[model samples]
Target: MIPELCDQRIRQFINGSDFVLAMNEDNHVFSWGDNHCGQCGRKATPFRVYLKPEVISDLNDKNITHICCGFKHSLALTTDGQVYGWGSYYEQYQNAEGSDTRVINSCENHYKSFFEELSDNPIGSGGFGTVFKVRHRFDEHIYAVKRIHKEDEIKNHMEVKNLVKVRSKYVVQYYNSWTEGIILYIQMELCEYNLQNILEVKLQVFGRQLGEAMDSVEYLISCEIFRQVLESVQYLHELNPQIIHRDLKPENILITLGKAMDCVEYLISCEIFRQILESVQYLHEMNPQIIHRDLKPENILIAENIRNGRFVKLCDFGLATVHDKRVHYRTTQKHTADVGDMRYIAPEVSQGGKYGHKCDIYSLALIGGNIFEIDLFNLELEDTNVYSELYQILNEPVYRLQTILISMFRTRLWHRRPECSEVLSEYNEWSIDRNILANDTRFDGILSILQSNDNHLFIELSAIGSGGFGTVFKVKHRFEEHIYAIKRVEIKDESEEYLQRFYNEVKNLIKVRSEYCVQYYNSWTEGNILYIHMELCEHNLQNILEVKQQVFDRKLGKAMDCVEYLISCEIFRQILESVQYLHEMNPQIIHRDLKPEN
Candidate 1:
C-alpha cells in the first residue's frame, strides 16, 4: 500500500503543471501547479487535463546532483560539476548580413550561442534560479554555473553586468552566459558554503541557545565579524553603480575554519576594514546608484577562511539592484511579487515605500542585534518593560545605554538612524574609550582621584607655555615626588562639547603610543582646572630652526645632525609609521596643527 501511494504521488507530481522537480541520482523531471513558460519541460498537447513528465534531452545521461528554480527559471547540476539551464530568454538580437567581403559591420552582436559546451555542473539553487559546479575540460578546474529562466533574463543580465564592473571582497565574480533552446545559462566562480551554515555551527556549539554562556571574547569576536560585514555592505552601497546586496542573511554568508584564533583576528584586523571602506567608497561614486534591496544573511556567502580560519568572504548577489534615479525600471507594474525576505526587510520596504542606503543600515542593525541578541531599536527606558531585563544583562547604568540604542534604531527613514560612516565613527570612539579604560590603571585611578579631591589640590607650577585651547605648566605632583606638565583649560560650565573634546584628546593621545608623537602620561581634573600630563621634549622644531639661524657653528650642524639622526632611528621610524597609520584612518583625519610646537 505504501509503494502504491508513493507511486501515485510521484505520478501526480509529474502530471501537475505547477510542480517542477529534478532528481540528482536519476535525471527525473516532475511538474505540477503552473507552467507558463513551458517550465514543466513538457511539450504542449492539443487538449489534455494535465501535463506528463517529459525527459529533457540535454540533461539525459547527465549524473544530475542538484536543481534550482527561480520564479520561472530552472537549473540542473550534474555529477561532473557541470551546470545546465533551461528557461525563457527576454534578450533580443539582430541578425545582419555583410553585402561584400570588404564591407564593414555596423551592428555588433550582443548575444552568445547557448549551451555550446558544458563546463560545470549545478550544485545549489536559489530564488532567482539554480547553480551548478562545472570543471574546465583541459585544466579540470571547477566553477559555479548559474542559470536564470528566460522569464528573468533581463534583470539577471543587468545584475551580471553590474557585478562584473564592481570589484569587492564581499561580492561574487560573474563569468559568462549563453542561451540554449529556451534557457539562459550564466557561469560564475563556485564558492564553498553560505553564512547560514557557519551560524548553525556556532549555534550548535552553544547548545542552540540564543544568549547562554556567551563570553566577552565571543562577543568581541562577533563584534569584529559584524564590523567586517558592515564594511563590505557599505562598500557595495557606495559604488558608482552603487550595488546593494538587498538580500543579506546568514545563509547567503559563507565561513571557513581556521587553525588558530589569531588567524581570524588578523583576517578582521583594522587594515582589512580600510580596504573594505575604500572599495565601498569607490562604488558610491559610480554614475548610477545601486541599492541592495535585500540585505539578509542568506544572500551573503562565506567563500573561504583568511588567515588560517580567522576571516570569511561574503557572496551572493541574486537580489542586488542598482539605485539609479535617472534610470528607473518599472518594477511595480512589471515583476510585482514581493522582492525581499520577511525577517530582514526594512520597515520602509515592508510599507512599500522607496528606500536607499539607509535601508541597508536598518538591516545591518538587525543583523547586529540578532548576533548580540540585543534590541538596538527599542531603548530600555525606566518606564519600559524591558528595562529590568536590560539592566540584568548589562549590569550597568541603563540611561546612557538606552540613549545610544534609541538613537541607533530611529524609525523615520531619514531621521531614524545614522549613516554607515557615522556608525563606524561611533564604534571607533567607543572601542578606543573602552581600550583606554581597560588598559590604563593610572588614568582610571586619576578619574577616581578627581572625583574625591574636588577643590583640594592647588596648582604650584610655573607657566611654561600657552596654546589656543589651554595652557601648559611644569608642576610637581602634590603627593608623588614627580614633575609633570599640567595642561589647564577654561570653558563654560555647560559646554559638553568642550569637555568631550578635552577628554577625547586625552583618550586619543593615550591610545596612540608612537615614538614620533608625544605620549600622554596621565590626566586629571581639580576644581575648575583640567590638567593633562605629557612627555616633555627639550626643543621644538621651530626653536631649533631659530637656533640654527642664530649661528651656523659646528655645534649647530652637529645638533641638526643629532636631531636628524634621532629622526632616522628605528624608534623614530616607528613614529613615522604611527603617523602614517593615523593618516590612513577612516574618515581621513588630518592633524591641522602639525607644526613643531603644539
Candidate 2:
C-alpha cells in the first residue's frame, strides 16, 4: 500500500518534461518522477526508483506562484521573483540528440544482481494491462511481468493485491510485485495460449460442421477448456478476500507450452468441468464470498505447454472486490462498480442491482451459451400476443441456459438466483455429492448435528412444534424434496444447564439405536442459530393425547377409545424399551426429558 493518500486533495499537478511536480492542499510540492539529474529536488538512493511520492518541505517558507516544464528540464517561479532551474542543460546536443532521457552510472542492486540485464522483452500491450517477458540469469526461468502504468494504478491496485495471494493450478500464478514511482511490476507465470485462441480455431475449423456434425470429439477441446476455466474461477472466488475475476476474458488467461498431443484430449471430458464446479462450491460456501462481474470465453486460457495443453488459467482482477456479505443489499447496490463486459454481464448487474456470488452463475451461464455456440439473446420468449425487445433480450440467455446450466436463474431478480455451490452438487454432469452432507462422521448425534458450523443445505419452513429445550421447525434441503424437523436452540450465551441437557440428549440418542426413535441426520451453527435436522414425525405423544381427548376429532384418532388405549400402551412400551436399550449399553444412558413433549 501507498499509505492510501485519498484523505488529501491535490491542488494542481503538472509533469515536467523530465520530472513530475504536484501541490497538495497543504501548499506542499510532492515530487517523484525522473530524478536522473537531481531535478526531483530530493536526495535518493542511487539507481533506485522513488516508489513512493515524497514531499518537498524545503519551499514551505516561499509562496510558490508558477511552475514550468521544459525538455529534460524544470523551472519554478516564486512570488518573490526568484527562479530556479535543474535538469539536463546540454544545449548543444538538445537539437542533435536522438533522446532527452539518459541513464547515469549507478551501483548494482543486491536483489536484482542474480538476474540478467533487462531485455526489451515486451510481450503485449493494451488499454487495461501490459505483459513483459523476463528471465533469471542463473536459473533461466521465464516470467511474465505486468506493467501497471500511473493513471491506471487505481484500477490495478486490487489486481496486484489479489494476484499475489492466489495459489491454484487453474489460476495464473503470481510471484512478486516491484514498485517504481507510479508504476508496479507484477511477476507471474507465462503462458502463450488462451481459450480465445482455441475458440477462434474451433470456430474457424469447425465453422461449417458446427450445426450438423456436432459430436463428442467436436466438443472435447471446448469442454476441457471450459472445465478448467471453472476450476480457476472457483479457486479465485474461494480465497479469503474471495477474489472475483471482474474482467474475465480470454486475453487475461495465461497458458504454458507443454506441446503434448493425445486422443484423450479429443474425448468428451467430465474431469475438467468437475474441478471447476467443486471450486465454485468451495467459494460459495465461504463467509463473505465473491462475484466475478465479467466472464466470457476470452477470460479462459489454454496452456498447451502444460499438462499436454489441457490446463486453464484465470486472470484479471481490476474490478474484483472482497465483499462483506453481511452488508445490506441496498448498501451493496449503492456501492456497486459500473464496470463489466456487457455481453456476458449478468442482467441484474447491467440493470444496476446489489447481487452476491450468484452473479458469477449468470456470467457462467453466458459462457455456457458461448461454448455451445448458442446465441442466448436471440431466443424467443413466450408470447402474450405481443413482443417486447427488452423482454426477449434479457430472458433469452437465461431461459436457454437454465436447461443446460442447472441452477435456476431469475433473470429479472438478484436474490432468486441459484447458489454457486448448489449447481455443482445438484446439476452439472460433473456434479458430486455435497461434501458437507457426505461427511456423516461430523454429525455424531443431535447436539453434534445442532452445532453444525453453518447452514446452507437446509431451508427452514414453518414452526411445527416446541419443547422445553428447543423449538422444532420443518425444514427442507434447499435442493432436495425431503422434509425434516430442525430442532433449533439459541446457542449465544447458552447456560451450562442447557448445554448439559442438550449434550445429555445427544448421548442418549447416540447410545440408543432404534427404529422407533426419531432419526438424526445433520446439524450446524450460524450466529445464534444452533440447529439439527432429524426425521419428522406426524405427531408426538402430546399431540396424540390432545387429539384422543376429543374422541376421534383428527384423522389419526378415528380409532375407538379401547383401540387408542392399546396404541398408547404400545407407544409407552416402545419408549420404555428405548430406555432399556440405553441402560444395557456399556455406558448407560437415560432420557431424563421423557415427558410427552420430549
Candidate 3:
C-alpha cells in the first residue's frame, strides 16, 4: 500500500512483504523498512518480519518525502521538510561498547526515547541514517540533521570519528551528533538536490528531444559542473585521512538548486577555470595518498552562485578506507575487487586485480565522456589492446573531449593512467595553450610573412645588439618605411640545423604572441650573414628592471607598473607562454638559464 505524507507531498509505500518506503514529491527515496538492529526504529517488533509496518513517532506529525537505505540502515524525510532517521546500522559499527552479534531488542529502550526534540524540515537520507534540514532554535541557521539508530550506534560513532579527522573542501562537513532518549541525531551543512537530480536535468537539456536550441550557456554550465566535480574529488583524495567517496554516484551528490537558479550565466568564466586548476594542484601536493573508489557524475555536487560555483563537493564516504603505499600496491597483487561503478570501472578493476588511484582516473574520464558526448565506451581500439585505444584517443586532436576522456581511461592499472599531479599538469598546459592561441595575433602575422615571398623590403642597417648566437641591427624597410630589429648570424649558424632551431623558437614565440614577447617580423640571409627582422621595441624587460633600480621616485612606480603591465600584456605573456611550450615540445627543451637577464 502506498501512503502519502509530508507537506512537500511525500509518499510512502508498504510493499507486499511489509517493508515501508517513503518518497518525496520529486520521487526520490526518503525512508524504507524496519530497523530492528535500529535499522528501522519506529517499526520495531520482537521478531524482525518483512511485512510489519510502524510509523516513526517523530515523522507522524510531519510530511517526509525521500529516503536512502544502506546495508541494514535507513534514513527518512518529512513533508514539513525535516529529516530524521532511526536505525542502528551506523551506531552498531561505531559504538565501542556495542557487540557485533547483539540481537534487535537490546537497543529498543534506548531507541524509543531518542525521537523527542528535533525541529523539522526534511532534507535527505543516507546508508547509515536519515539527514534532516533544521534551523537553529535560537539562530535559525540551517543544518542537516542525521538520525542514527541505537543498534548501529557503534558504526555511526566510527563514521563520525572518521568524519572529524577528514578536512577537505570536497567532502561534506559534519557538525555534531547527540542522543536524546532513543534517537541519535547528527547535524551537518544543509545541501540542496543530489547529483542524481542535477544529472536528470542535464539529460533533459541535452537530449535529442531538446533539439538544436540547446543553449551554449547550458553546455558551458555543464562543463563548469564537470570541472568542479573533478576538483572536489581531487581534494578529497588529497586529504590527511585520504578519504575516498567509494559510493560516488548521482544520488550521493547534492546541488544547491536555489543557488544555481540564481546564478548569472557568465559566472563560469576563465577565472573559475583558474580557481579549479589551482585547487586540483593543491590537492595533488597533499601528503598521504587518497583514492576515490567510486567516481561518477552523481558523486560530484555543484554549489549555488556560478562564480562561487566552485563549491563542488564530493559526498558519501560510507565505503571509504585508508590505504598506504605498501598496502595499495599489495592490494593490487592480491586481486581485490571492491572498486567502482560498472560503466566507469577501469579494466584493471574489472579484472579483479590490484588497482590504485587510477580507478578514480578511469571513472573521472567516464564522467567527462558523458558530459562531452564523447564515445569513449565504444571507441574503436587502435589494436586489440584497450590501453592502445586509450593512448590513441589521447593523441587525437580533433575531439578534445575524447582526448581528455581517453587520457583519464588508461587501461593498465600501473601504466594505464596518470597520477593526479600529471592530470593537473596536462590540464594547465592545455588551458595555457588555449588562452595563448585565442588572444595572440603574432602567429597569424608570421604565417602571413611565410606565405609571401616579396623581397622589396630587405635593406642593410646598423648593428643594435650582439650576442654569441647572433647580432641584432636596427633596420628600416625601404618599401614600407617600417623600422624593425634584425638579428644577423653567420651562414654556418643559418644552416638547416640552426635554421630549424630558430624556427622552433619562432614557432614557440608565435604560439605565445603576448605583448611581452619579442615579435618576429621576417627572415633572410646575405652571403655568410643570416638576418631575422623583428619588431623594434626601445627596451626589453631586463633593461626596464635595471632602469627601475637606478631611477627611483615616481619613475620607479611607473617602471614597476610598466613591468607588471608588460608582464600581463600580450607580449610578455607570449614570452612565458613560449617557455612553457618549448618545455613540453618534442624532446622537451629546457631554458637552462632563466633569470632577470637572458
What candidate 3 gets wrong by more than 4 Å, as runs, is 1-121, 205-215, 257-598
Candidates' RMSD to native:
28.9, 26.0, 27.4
For model 3, residues 1-598, the per-residue Cα lDDT tens digits are: 3343445465544331224555544343433344354555444444454433334434332334556565555555543344554445454555664223322222333223323223354566667777765556544455566777778766766666555555345667765544555676666666756767655555443332545543333455567778888988887777755777687787776664221110111112223433433443443344655555666667766666556446665665543344466766655444357456665556666656665555666666666555434445344335333221212332323244345556666443355566556655555333323433333365556446656543335565677667666777787776578888877777465568867765665565556455535777556655665566678865665776666555544454454457555544865666777687757666666766565555
Pick by lDDT: which candidate is best? 2
**Model 3 — which ten-residue stretch has the worst lDDT?**
258-267
Error of 1 at 504 (Å): 60
For residue 332, model 1's alpha carbon misses the true position, in angstroms, by: 70
Per-residue lDDT of candidate 1, residues 74-185 (tens digit) = 5566544456544332233112431112111111211222222232444567887877655555444455666678786567666655555554566665555555545666
For candidate 2, write residues 1-598 as lDDT tens digits: 3353455587777786546777766455666666655556664334435435776645433345666666555556654344555556547434354223432212234225534433465676777567766666556666666777768656676676555456467777766554455666666777756656555556444333446653333354457668888888988777766876777888766556532211122112234443444545555666676555665567656566765434655556566555566574535334374557755566556546566676777777656544433333322334331211222332333333334453333254556666656555544332222332333353334335456543656777789887667888887876566888888887656788766766665655555557756887766566767677789885777876776756654465354567767877898898887667767767666555677866
